[model samples]
Target: MRVALLILAVVVGSVIFNFTTPFHLGQIASNWGLIDVTIWITFVLCGLAFIILGILMAWWIYTYQYQPGQLAEYEPEDPVLEGRLTILTTIGVVVMLAPGLIAWNDYIAVPEDAIELEVFSEQWTWSFRLPGEDGIFGYAHNKNIDIIANPMGIRDDDPYAQDDLVIETNIVKVPVDKKIKVLLRSKDVLHDFWVPEIRAKMDSVPGMVTYFWFEPTRTGVFEILCAELCGSSHHAMRGEMHIVTREEYQLWLDDQITWAERKAGVVPLTPVQQLGQTVARDNGCFACHNTTGAAGTPGPTWKGMWGTEVELDDGSIVTRDEAYVRESITNPGAKLVKGFSNTMLQLSDDVTTEDIDALIEYLKTTTPAVE
Candidate 1:
């Protein structure tokens, strides 16, 4: 009885600790309450088994304690007790598995009205694409991927791809209260797209598309994290998501560039600018600094930033002129941008003056000052 009371006390303490635990499942902003329910069911079933088995063990130990004059009788194979135990174990297993199966069924049953969004990932970076006005995505493949010309590798033969809105940066926006079917793709290796508040995550396998859906129930900015370890820089792979009203979402969408516009060279680049663009891509500069106007990129975007006043980590202001640009290439650690880490990859010593000049020309094109 004392042993049983101690077991009871332990169970009671566990229950209290669970309730008072500081660790929480941050925010449940999606239609996945069933996931939470399934977890609770699992916890209850496991706890009950632990208590029952623990008490039984205690009882048997106390009842069968060695007595000096008592000879123990080996009652091997009690069919009735064995049968009862088997039945109870089977019931418990089924109870634990049923909720998970049901939750998985609900997971894949995406609503027909759900809008499709594509998430494309590469080593330490993220990009997104959405369908055009026709609500259809163009065919894209890994073999056709290009760093600049065909970033997401949208096939040239697919007319649906022309109008597909491409967001080259890590940040993306979606409308609140709408179902979004996220299609995941990876250019190089495996990755996992995870947003904790939404309770939705899926693996992005190279050469194949994997997906999951969720309906945002609230409006807020959520952090996007790579839940899978892909490379040395995997921890640095992160993005931002803004869940906004339909009107705001639409406004943001309208400002995006389409594949056709990019292909057509809507924003033409000069010869020097083109050379600079190639230099930047070849040097892996775009891996951190964004070419697009997105604000949440790891490094400050070159777009609309030329000739603009910039603040440095030491609280000094400097103009993004030719001299500053040249110094940044030759000596990267000189001026660290505010709110950004000093993780900039240094240029090789052999990087020629001509290459720096070409890169500066390309950087100039990113700003509105060129046009």
Candidate 2:
């Protein structure tokens, strides 16, 4: 009696708890409400099975209590019982899986008028690219992935790439109520783009591209997370996606400079200037520092940095003189820079002394007179 009652209590308690539980899907901000219906269908099927099985188990245990003198039947196979069980199981599976298959059709069918949004994911950061005024995206290949000039691997000869806006930041912006077909790619290993509120996610695989589409129905900032266990710093691989009005989105997009301007905008430099840029690219300096003084980068801008009073992590102010620049390159850990991570590796072994001298000379030409 106690065992049967306990089993009955488990079913009742479970049903009550499930209904009253605070954990549930977040508010819908996209047009995929049918996905919720599909999920609920699965939950109902599983919950009904659990309850029925629990009650049946309790009834069997109570009715089939052991008897010392009573002999047990040895018949093993029951064709009628087997058929009924198989039919019921099949019905349950169909109930749960059928809706998902139907919803999947809509999930893959992107609308014709959707905008193309390119997402480039790396080990620890996320970057985005948008089509230029031509509404066409340039071709990209892994071989053309120049970290400094062409981070997106866009073809050098493609005229369409000239005006494409490439944003290397932690923020992704989209106009509300507009379908955006995201083109996902990765520079290294596998990664996944997930935003809980949007209820959409897709993996980013290297040497290949995967895509998905979503339309934001409301305006807000949504958190982006890497769903895959990518690497050691997978948890910290996060960013933000802001959905705003069309006017706000256009204003922000218009301010971004194009790839052509970034690549060929600088005039022909002197031999020393050429050497400095070459050495910097070879050492992957542009991975952090930008020549254009782009905001929200990892390292300080190289533009107008020379002869400037910069503060170090140790609360000491120092000028960006030749000696300081050399020290910062060779012994970066000795005096860390404020507002930047202590993540830069030592370049002493990478560059020669002559190369360092030319880099300093190059910075001299870039720095403008304060007056």
Candidate 3:
């Protein structure tokens, strides 16, 4: 009965391990390079140890079979065996810990020449500010986002921030083989900036700045996702990062700053229009909805949408005139487009009537330029 029970236990254990261990083990191994290798080594060592113990136990059970006059021999603990086990366990611990210590050291050490980038999280979008040619970022504030003053809140007094680039889009570009330090902060709620390829992640908490550094070894686009759930759009919160050659990255940064300046110069219908653009951005509308007539997007194109004919949820189509646009902006579910989900938030409290009108006017004139 005891032998049968032991066999049953082994079978159950094998079944459970076979079914559940691979996925979680693979996930952990893929995430941490050092841990991944260490885990395999540990697995091999543990497997060997379990096999050795199992063989010895089986031998003891077979040899001491209770058949009539059969007798069991008892063996005392050996000091040499204890010492050997101690040494083996120590070696295993060192093997496991060495790589972890090295990885931690590398993680903490920031290169002197690393580029500093500030990432601001608000609502559901990420805004990035890269240092200018001066290798310094100027003091910035949301209040100074006004047109007359330094647009984008770049402090004029700070010489370093004079030429800094501010990007509102979801795409981030960085030079290959260069160390980067990202400073993260949140405007509203807690958010986490994570990129798996670089093995770098950091939290963005409200009213505080957190930082992480990494160097990209590969030149390709990687996904940037919010590791922490923020709100209703948590699952849909995603962005992209472009890792490119040094020359390309420099050109890209220069173009971004120039584009931001040009955009600041273009006058909107009203101050509220300007504010609406900022609010629309902060609310993550640009992720799925494109101002440009981009292809393969999830929602309706905003370009020339203000005055176009839009189909409604009730099998009725209507011209996107002022009142219709206003209704769409304030209450998106009131007239849901057939192909799009009714996921748009009601801007009744966050946005004013004047703001919606200005945004509509801005939408009428501004169209995204194809790259």
If scored against the real structure, what TM-score would every candidate get?
0.65, 0.67, 0.50
| Ten-residue stretch with the least lDDT total in model 2 | 265-274
Judged by TM-score, which candidate is best?
2
Candidate 2: the clashing residue pairs are: none
Each model's lDDT: 0.85, 0.84, 0.69
* TM-score of model 3 (CA atoms): 0.50
Error of 3 at 57 (Å): 13
Q: Write the per-residue lDDT of candidate 2 for residues 161-224, one digit (tens) a residue.
A: 8778877776777999999999999998899999888888889999998987888999998899
Supply every candidate's count of residue pairs whose N, Cα or C atoms clash at under 3 angstroms. 0, 0, 1
Which candidate number maximizes lDDT?
1
lDDT of 3 by residue, 238-306 (tens): 888888889877646544643235346633233344445656665667876787688677668787676
Off by over 4 Å in 2: 1-13, 264-371
Candidate 1 pairs with clashing backbones: none
